[model samples]
Target: MDYKSYPVVENIFGISGLNANLANILMITVCSAIVLLIGVLSARAIQMKPTGMQNVFEWLIDFVKGIINNTMDWKTGERFLGLGLTIFLYILIANLSKLPFVITTEPGHVVWWKAPTDDPLITLTLAAIIIVLTHFYGIKIKGFGGYGKDYFKPVPFLFPLKVIEEFANTLTLGMRLFGNIYAKGILMALLVSLGVSGFFGFFAAALPTIAWQAFSLFIGAIQAFIFLMLTMVYMAHKVADDH
Candidate 1:
């Protein structure tokens, strides 16, 4: 798997060396637009009795509510419903996008799309955003003094350890998602390479590719749920009175 970076425009205008993966960024943007569209369509016309897209959206909202409610009370959790819903929908769409057929000349050179979550920069940025938001809320709920005091909890000796834990959480959260999705992409690339060998190789690759894609779908859903659940849990730790 070629893990090398693809320049955003190879060169923007006349200048060179603007580091960006435009393909991944575009995929993320497209996924975000799709999620937004679905949200709008779902609520375009509210029915006296919900049906179709409305029902599906309602169910998903309820499911996200449950994640928040599990970690904290509905009162506090409901405040973050938008974040939870957006993360789940966007990640799900991005993850599954790779499953569709791609007419590419080579593996890993998929032009139009790649899973956004598979990119470490995207995943880490998301993790940092969630972590930073939690800190902001912590400061809001607990005074600055109260929030700072958390690092010295149990014993003053553990202050450094507690501080380091924050960094650890950010890295683990981002890398876990990136590693899983990236591995799936790499596996798909490998399968594609095998299929290109010859006619026999193509048939041999078919079943395994289908199986792995199915399993990758399951992993994607589970990862999305895990990310949402972890976000809520982190928020709970920051906002709950007991913490």
Candidate 2:
């Protein structure tokens, strides 16, 4: 479906002078809250014999930890793990929130909340934060000179290109995430509007939408991993003075 045409949940506040973007912010805040609640509750209720939810949550944490450990030195990884873990959880939930079943009612209101990550501003803001934090961590770990040396690697003449690359890379990372999730929403809208028989809609349309949602879920997970993984790798290379 044409993404430009999807009904966006707009200015829900109905306030005369409120920030229009407030709708998006509110959505993100809510999603963050949910992720936080789930994470804390999962952590607080310890279990010798794990339930399925606990197992799944723990498995995800371990998976993220493994990424950190594999991509970075123990000292740096330990320092960033708390922040990185939070990034993964927030992005995952934000992307997954785009899938169907996030229903809403009331005239002039579409979904009160779209996926937080679907917004360009939000995604890029996150990308900016990740990049800034990575650089900050690099400076903290290896002093300012080490971080500076990374840009002029192999040849001092390469500094300008490297600087451009850094900005472009983060920009791509943010936009890639926003594009994929937003496209999925448009695709599901297409499935729902294909003008097929009700049974065909259920079996043919709904079925694939389910599969796509599941696939999108996987995509969301991978994107989150890739974003944080790159951050770690960027820092690793920065701190590795020889590079």
Candidate 3:
């Protein structure tokens, strides 16, 4: 991949040499719009007896509720239902976006479209946001003093380790998603290149491409669920008194 071929805006917002990846930005916008559309269409009309999208939407709600229940009390987790649902849906869509096809420009072979989650910057930003929100809720649910005290619970010697753990959590959470999606992208690209090499190469690549694509769908869903579950788990640790 020619990394330099990416459509980037340098010196963004007048900051010297700050850069923004247009491809990632575009993919994020597209994924968010799809999620929003799903929300609107699914909930457009309430029925005396739910069917179709309503059923799917309600099922998703229950799924997220179960996740929250597993991590923390429903009373505490109920307020986060929307947050959890949105995250789950958005990540799910983003992960699956590039499975069907990848678009690239000629000559430089610049990627015009792909899963946003495959990008480290996007994944790390999401992880950072979640971590920040966990801290926010921790302070809101427990007083600042209470939350702060948990960092030193049982002993004061572990404070530095706990601090380091927060950073570790952020890195692992982000890189886990990025690594999986990015690897899948790389494998798919290699398969495509092989198919285009010659007739014999095409036959050799076809079966593996199909198999990988099928497996990738399952991998995408699992990754999304893992991300959601971990988010709640982290949140539980931050807000729960027993943690």
Candidate 4:
């Protein structure tokens, strides 16, 4: 398939020629709703002996808590448990959103469904949000003067490098996720195309496609964990005095 044939729904507004990716907007909304629904359903009933959704939810909470404890003292990290869990769930769902199937429209082959993380814009936006929140918490926990002075700590010359590091962190965090998900998306698309080619091609691609999907699910979970870990690490750097 020609890459140029990939359809994107965009609308230009105002004289600046700015456009919005309608497909990404839709997918983000859907993913957010799914995450919210899970949270609601999982917490609807509380029991001493957890089962089903509650058990899964408790496991996830414990996992996030472990990540926070590893990065910073629990006293400081306890506040971010909700943030960490939400990020993990949202990203995991977004990463796996396109795995079950691919949807495209005829006449133009416009992609109608895909993982939100497959787009650099979405991933980068997430990175920016996390980075900004770190700054917010840093200033909140440490006074503005203290937060500003951390850049020049130990020596004054490191300030420039510290400034640059923030930008690097955001770029790397976002690109790392986008690269992994986008590559997976491309390979899945290829396998799907092969499966549709003919009977022989379908048979040849079926097993590999299924196997790749299972691996993709693992990759998606790992990526979510990595993202959550890094977020807490960065948060600790900002909010913890020992860092």
Candidate 5:
């Protein structure tokens, strides 16, 4: 099947190309809204003995804390507990949200929503943000001059290599997510094409699609965890005194 990207803002702004990844933007917005709503609702009624939404949210927070503690000391990592929690939950939601087949009015054009992580722009933007924050925190903790001197530690010639390493990390972190999620999208599209080809093809692809969906959920969760873990590692490397 031919592919055509949708631009949710195209009509309003008449922009395309990088601006055309609007569906991913919309999905990210939707996921953010849902996450915020869940947080609000869960916190609306707090009890000494937590249950249901409160319990789940607390558990999630502790789980994220565990992840942070694994990478950094509790004192330093606790400050980032919320950030880690938000990234993990937001990415997890974004990843699995694409599993449902969208109803579309036209072929090629994306439906109202798509997985934000499936878009490199979205993933790379997130990766860049994470790296930027790492630099910020490094400076905040170690002073601007201290953080700057890190690039040339043990030798003055390693500055360029260090810069290249940061760029590579950002590219790899983002592309890894986009590649996996995009492959899942392609698999879904192929299965859909198969289902539309003939009665026999429909039967042949139906079960496989369902099976793949289950497997994709694992992939999605793992990617989210990997992203979260890497983010923590990058942050730790920047802020830690060990250099």
Candidate 6:
């Protein structure tokens, strides 16, 4: 089995989980805990005019809030602000982790705890969560009847098509993030196989890899934004009508 093709799963309290991939619930749990702890501690990093980590998180919160406001009505978008911000930071850090030094030579060729986004399962799971959230909120805002009527869309006769589109959109959302991030891993694997410095690798080989890493970071953020936007869009659509 190509280690690359298979999840880096490790047994954890009975369940086999991803070893190097973020699919490992344990790893994600740890990461999430760290983020939460930091967020809690830094909630008031700066009282007057925040500095350091507090400043960064505040700016991030403001940034996510702005995105929500611009893309969705204030009333509708407020609910998703935390999710959007969490997704952005979780994914941003995950992607950026790839740019740093990696340990490599681990059980599953692990390195630098590579960004969670680099793992498709993680992205797909997140996509599923987003879809679920959209539906949950959709049903919450609109009654069960309204949620069901959403499938019929513009007209009752369009039920089948509407259902297909809704299903397709959710799958596509996951696939979009998965495909790009997974591709990054593939590229990195190829480069590492060449036994050279990475673009950011202190060694000379890093020259080329750095450019790719930068591009990956850009892609990561864009994907995160798109995912959040789609979440809001889906929610808005669901709540907008009862067919």
**Better-scoring candidate (lDDT), 1 or 5:** 5
Indicate the worst ten consecutive residues by lDDT in candidate 6. 1-10
In model 3, where is the ten-residue run with the lowest total lDDT? 5-14
lDDT of each: 0.80, 0.74, 0.88, 0.88, 0.83, 0.67
Off by over 4 Å in 5: 1-20, 100-102, 107-110
lDDT of 6 by residue, 56-131 (tens): 7888888888877766677777877788877776765565555433434446644435556655677778777877
lDDT of 1 at 195: 73
**Model 4 off-target regions past 4 Å?**
1-16
TM-score of each model, paired residue for residue: 0.88, 0.83, 0.92, 0.92, 0.88, 0.77
Off by over 4 Å in 3: 1-16
TM-score leader: 4
TM-score of model 3 relative to the true fold? 0.92
Stretches of candidate 1 exceeding 4 Å from the true structure: 1-17, 100-112
Q: What clash pairs does model 5 have?
A: none
Task: For candidate 2, write residues 45-75 as lDDT tens digits.
Answer: 7799977668878787788788777876566
Positional deviation of 211 in candidate 4, in angstroms? 0.5
Q: Is candidate 2 or candidate 4 better by lDDT?
A: 4
Candidate 5 per-residue lDDT, tens place, 147-234, comes to 9988998799988999999999999999999999989987887786777678998899899998999999999999999999999999
Residue 102 of model 5 has an lDDT of: 52
lDDT of 4 by residue, 1-243 (tens): 443454443322344686676678789999999999999999999899999999999999999999999999999889999999999999999999975555666655656678999899899999999999999999998989989999998899999999999998899889999999989988887787788778998899999999999999999999999999999999999999888
Clashes (backbone N, CA, C under 3 Å), per candidate, total 0, 0, 0, 0, 0, 10
